[model samples]
Target: MALVCFGIDKFPDHCNFVNGGDGSVSTQTVEKTSTNRKLAPRYRVLLHNDDYNPMEYVVQVLMSTVPGLTQPQAVSIMMEAHTNGLALVITCALEHAEFYCETLKNHGLTSTIEPDE
Candidate 1:
């Protein structure tokens, strides 16, 4: 008599066995579940204030790179960046965030990505 276990670890939390005489084979379904927990460090792309960069240019950058930000929203964020010295441009995976920061820099705007505190 042999038993087969599926969809579970080698040492299953539960087990099922089948009899040879019966025509039906027993199936065991093991599901691994997970909840959203703060696992890895998250990153945020930020725009920093600069005396040299024009506010309109910052607004343009925000409108171009940061999705879903309207002209007004972009202007608001840019103004915050100006007054507060830093403003969040976007939140995403580190690679993407870093790419955005670099792109902002390439566009002659001061930007950076750091782990969200």
Candidate 2:
């Protein structure tokens, strides 16, 4: 049950050795990798105001179509769209954004996807 610290200056970028109660010693190494690759571009899922779709229907569609959208969040988005001409529902990867946009459209709600700045 003895704990020994090695290369404390390096902290998390170093290795750790632990002694178990069964008289066994284990070695664990912590590694950090630096990647130069850029992340995938994100897209914005926008809900457009419409005359045909009801407010409640828009909220329901937004909550169902987009993942991680809460009821209050959906209502806020719907209200935004109602007040303005459009509202941003979410910012996510292109495929996910497209899927959400399509799902909203299928539910008779006006939605679109555009590259996020």
Error of model 2, residue 73, in angstroms = 0.5
What are the TM-scores, per candidate, against the unseen true structure? 0.66, 0.69
Tell me the deviation in Å of residue 54 in model 1: 1.4
For residues 7-116, could you state the per-residue lDDT of candidate 1 as single tens digits? 46664655555556666766455556686788666799998999998888888988888778799888888989988999888888888898889989988999988898
Report the number of the highest-lDDT candidate: 2
Off by over 4 Å in 1: 1-40
Q: Any idea how many clashes model 1 has? A: 0
Model 2 Cα lDDT, one tens digit per residue, 9-84: 8665366778987989887776756868999999999989999988988888888887788999999999999999
The residue pairs in collision within model 1 are none
Model 2 scores a TM of 0.69
